[model samples]
Target: MGESIVITSGKGGVGKTTSTANISVALANFGKKVVAVDGDIGLRNLDIILGLENRIVYNLVDVVKKRCRTKQALIRDKKNENLFLLPASQVDDKSAVTPEDMKELCSELKEEFDFVIIDCPAGIEQGFKNALAGADSAIVITTPEVSPVRDADRVIGLLQHHEIPASLILNRLSVQMVERGDMMSREDVEDILAIKILGLVVEDQEIVNAGNLGTPAVLNQNSPAGQAYLRIAQRILGENVEIPSFEEKKGFLARLLGR
Candidate 1:
């Protein structure tokens, strides 16, 4: 059976979905049979991020409603044979499924996959509860900003309350800003969240570019953020890996802005 992990963030727009898509792809590339479950229900975007939206014939709701079997809802990744996605329904409401249903679905998937990664929705609502219910562990994604860090703390507390182990993924960090003390440092984020750091993804334009093309940055070797995500995936697989520091060039824009 595979380990179940939930990629969650209390606050939205913290790259939770992006992390789920890329990490799942990264793991699949390593030959692990990986399945990513979109737990965001009506607001699901994991399918879009994986470029599998058009390929989704059945959704989570369909499986729960007995409209189709679990395998019917599993969409294979076009680029990776080992990767599959269980997309959430865009038309069905979030209340259509419960935590127990998610747990049962994950238990079923675990029998066939090496890893099941759930893309949890934002906030501490029913959606979030359903996502975490089936998770063996969790990856909390957050930006280095104060608000994100604060929200991450809350999420960590909730995870602890549920007796679920969790690690931190600090995303969208600007190394230039950190070097200039203009932004929170990685250490600062760790201290605030008070969790073992899983990895750090630097703010890179390549990530945005890859997303626009519906390709995960992890597939791009030249991308720094992509490399970071790959390392995170390795860590999740119980590899003793070191998180690399991203060195950014302090260009004219920084000096011109007095940063």
Candidate 2:
């Protein structure tokens, strides 16, 4: 059986969905059969990020309601046959499917793919719970901000409650801001929410451009953020890939805070 991994965030806009798309593509590049699930339901953007939005004829709700088979609902990736997208229904309400629905869906997908990545909706609502229901493991994404970190802590606790192992992905980090003391350093966020770091995605305009263009950042060989995502996928496959630091100096935060 394959693994079912859910990518979630405490709040939106922390690169959760984007990470899901890019990571799925990265795994596919490694010759793994990966399926990216748009667990966001009504507010689906995973399809847009995966650049398969226009091809979504069947969706999560359809499968839950037995309107289509799982294979029929899956849209093949434009670039890689190893990757597919199980899109969420844009017309259906977020509450239309229960946690049980997601559990069954993920269970089914994992049997056919090497990795089933569910891009969860932001926050600690029913949507979040629904996404968490079938996760064999999870990734809680956050920025370096205080609010996002706090929310990540809450999510980590919830994941712990569900007995699911969750690691952290500190996304949209700016090394320059950390050095200049204008932003929270990686240490600052880690101190608040103690968890294993899965990866660190530096802030890159290319990620935004890629999303707008319906291409995964990992597809851009020139992008540093894409390279980081490649390493993240390696780690996921049980490789001891070293995660790089975002700061020029390790103790930048300690010196700034006089700790």
Instruction: Output the number of the lDDT-best candidate.
Output: 1
lDDT value for candidate 2? 0.90
Model 1 Cα lDDT, one tens digit per residue, 1-259:
8999999989999999999999999999999999999999999899889988889899999998889999999999999999999999999878999989999999999999999999999999999999999999999999999888889999999999999999999999988788777899888887777899999999989988987888999999999999999999999888999987654445668767977
For residues 32-100, could you state the per-residue lDDT of candidate 2 as single tens digits? 999999888889999999899899899999999999999999999988999999999999877989999
Clash numbers, per candidate: 0, 0
Q: What shift in Å separates residue 169 of candidate 1 from its native position after superposition?
A: 0.4
lDDT of each: 0.92, 0.90
**Each prediction's Cα RMSD?**
3.4, 3.2
lDDT of 1 at 113: 97
Q: What is the TM-score of each predicted model, taking all chains together? A: 0.94, 0.94
Candidate 1 Cα deviation (angstroms), residue 94: 1.3
